[model samples]
Target: MGFKFDWFMKGMLGAVLLAFLWPEPGAKGGFLQPELLNKLGVALVFFLNGLALSLASMKDGALRWRVHLLVQCSTFLLFPLLGVALLWGSAGWMAAPLQIGFFYLCALPSTVSSSVALTIAARGNVAAAVFNATLSSLIGVLLTPLWMAWVLHQSGGNFAVGPVIVDLLLWVVLPLVLGQFSRPLLKDWASRHKGLLQKVDRITILLLVYTSFADTVKEGVWSRYNPLLLLQTVAGCALLFLLVLALTQWGARLLGMPRGDRIASVFCGSKKTLASGVPMAHLIFGANPAIGLILLPIMIYHPLQLLAGGMLAQRWSSAEAAPS
Candidate 1:
């Protein structure tokens, strides 16, 4: 337990340090060019996603359908609505760019690798985790843009959903679909090379984070958002995380879900996917590179969520082992 906590904390600290230390010469060029390093990181992330998914053991009969339904509601319908409401309420006060960032974060999908890892650590239903993660990614491609359009429209921004959808289909959905289709040929190889792939996943995420933060720094986004606003964003994200975590857990219990399914629902439903969000942000809001600053909430919250969720899972697993 101590080892796991130590490792997680160290990895997070490393990521944060890397974000600050990574050079930002590209940002000075006045264009958000896709550096070869960043593109390679994105591709590696997708490849590992495909590999991790292939190793997942999903049993159709194992899950409680009602629990899955509850998860979907929390992830797809409930969270997006909350995000729209928050943005609408703050529209009069928030800067236009930050408003877009808030909306974009809300529309993003749930995390995949971390979700399953936490679920497995907690002794939850891994298969359900995979299913929910994959399904959320698929649905998010469409839902994110739609929800963003609605939010932006309400906020009086001129956002065209059609172009967003086209971009999503081209960049996010198609890569995922191709990865899924290639799973048969890659799964065995991935299994054999799990260690190497794991390293690749870690490196890719680190590069993505560095590039993203570099963009924010380059765009003068940090200066635009003061300390107070940064704190507010963090508070808002914490509230959002707590709300979803509680709601998902309560819904799971209310539906009489088993322990494993409940764990899966809570972890999978409560989190957002950075892997998907970073790429989608580049595709959808590339015109404004500063839009990546909006993802800060998720980026900040992701590690916190994982640390908290992991500890909770560890506790639950220990309790389950105690004899009656």
Candidate 2:
């Protein structure tokens, strides 16, 4: 009935349909060329993301600086540190490429659209959500590469940070800036067509996932990972999500933040953007097909974060309305 449940069901149904329709992993010939389809899908996704973003709403100065700081620290700092620790602990057991993927996932930015959506759904500070989400994207362009380079260097892998930054500018930053600039003209139109825009967003994300998964299947990358290891990685992701959610919520409360700001902090701080993460993966790990395999953890985590945050937001809203 609710949008959250409806979307979750759609995602699950889509994933199922994809798995069944394209059962064979490496069979390439399909309805369309995968590369072109992927590029088109990604473009549409970013465009809708741009439309959904309200730069007008971003001017609100209601954010508690302390809460914002804590969100950034958790998203950019603490998460990566935990990833590094995981890599170290799993060094003897896990494959090198998978380890790199783990680290890469940790370095990604906080999600923009979903974070804002969840925050708003939770009756949180939407403007603060936008600010932090935007800041995370800008910060991620630089920080993700640096963190990746550091991890790779330690692991005796060769990575060029300069090229990565250049690619990021071309692929992520430029488009984002263009979207921001174009928002003024499109904002009113987009508001009137919110349902259409949401449809576009969902379709775009589904296509992106389909292509990325197709690529991984075509490369036989999934074969490298055993079912048990895959299960463990998924379990690890769940635990990490819970830990971050708890930590962010606790940190926000400790900072004496209002309910709205606390919700924004928890939603924005705890989640990573698959939309951003997928594009970055295509740029960074494109040469090594195995690298795409690393994004699986993030893909699994993204939808779960949305569903969980949606439920939590509803609960919080009810609690707030109750007479004490």
Candidate 3:
């Protein structure tokens, strides 16, 4: 709960460095055949998620309609609009694909693990955090693509939602549904090996990040930019996170949410899932040369959200524990 640096975020940075150094193995047509591995790993990630999901936990959180509405709207609706406004306001500041990356960042769902963890750390409504985070991921499988397709079309790029949705159903939803169906038989094992399953999730995501950045490097996407560009991206991502964080808290207060629900809303509503975003980017963008550039905002935002949310959680926890 204290502001400790997360090793997984460290691993994410290490993955990018590896990709920047030796991109061949993870790049397309490389020895690893990353395209095939990507597809499999992505499906496996979601399948394991379905297996781990507890219906009882979700149900306990499901009845809080007001909390759920606020969280979901903040995640899906508020963030994307912010992306649009940023894109409009910045006009010629960056290239089109990079701008699209910012939009893609906004369009992603709330993260599952960190949001729930931070909520628990802050003595928030963990049940609602779990429900809203999981629901956002599922909804994002559909909405993210639709949002992307519309944006790409507006920019004169072709992104066919129909084909992408069908592919997602096969690789994402089908595996998830199958895992859920098999849960009755395997839930006990999953619970017992929770740490192992979580490692699997992180490994898959790391692999995706490596391959994605590797592809970008192989295509010389980074050559067009400099260190200042990354700094600019970090600043932009930080600003976006702060705005969403403030707005979610404001909305929760306006609704007169309890302390726990407010904590859950602020944490869950403000997160963007690196887990879902990376895999979905690979699926949606499909080997576009600028893939790494497209993911830059999200990769940056992931750690920023964690650090900020973790600090806030610790402060809130201490405040709650203090004698009144």
Report, for all candidates in order, the number of backbone clashes.
Answer: 2, 0, 0
lDDT of 1 by residue, 1-324 (tens): 212444434664565565456536434342435455555555556645654664345555235587569767887888887777777687666666765666576677788777888888888887888888777776787888777777767767677788777756655555666777888888788779988877766656655555666666666776775667767777777888888888898989999988988988898888887667766665566556565566667666766677778777889888888898
Which stretches of model 1 miss by more than 4 angstroms? 1-24, 28-32, 35-44, 61-63, 92-96
Reference-based TM-score of each model: 0.84, 0.85, 0.97
The TM-score of candidate 2 is 0.85
Cα lDDT computed for each candidate against the true fold: 0.70, 0.74, 0.90
- As for candidate 2, its clashing pairs are none
For candidate 1, list the clashing residue pairs, or say none: 110-273, 111-273
Poorest 10 consecutive residues by lDDT, candidate 1: 1-10
* Candidate 2: residue 184 Cα off by (Å): 3.1
Error of 1 at 61 (Å): 5.5
Over 4 Å off, model 2: 1-44
- Quick one: best TM-score, which candidate? 3
lDDT of 3 by residue, 1-324 (tens): 755556778788899999999999999998889889889988998899889877777888898888999999998999999988988877787777789999999999999989999999999999999999989988998899988998888878877788789879988999989889989999998899999999889988999999999999999988887668788789899999999999999999999999999999999999999888988898899758899889999999988898899899999999999999
- Model 1, position 54, has a per-residue lDDT of 47
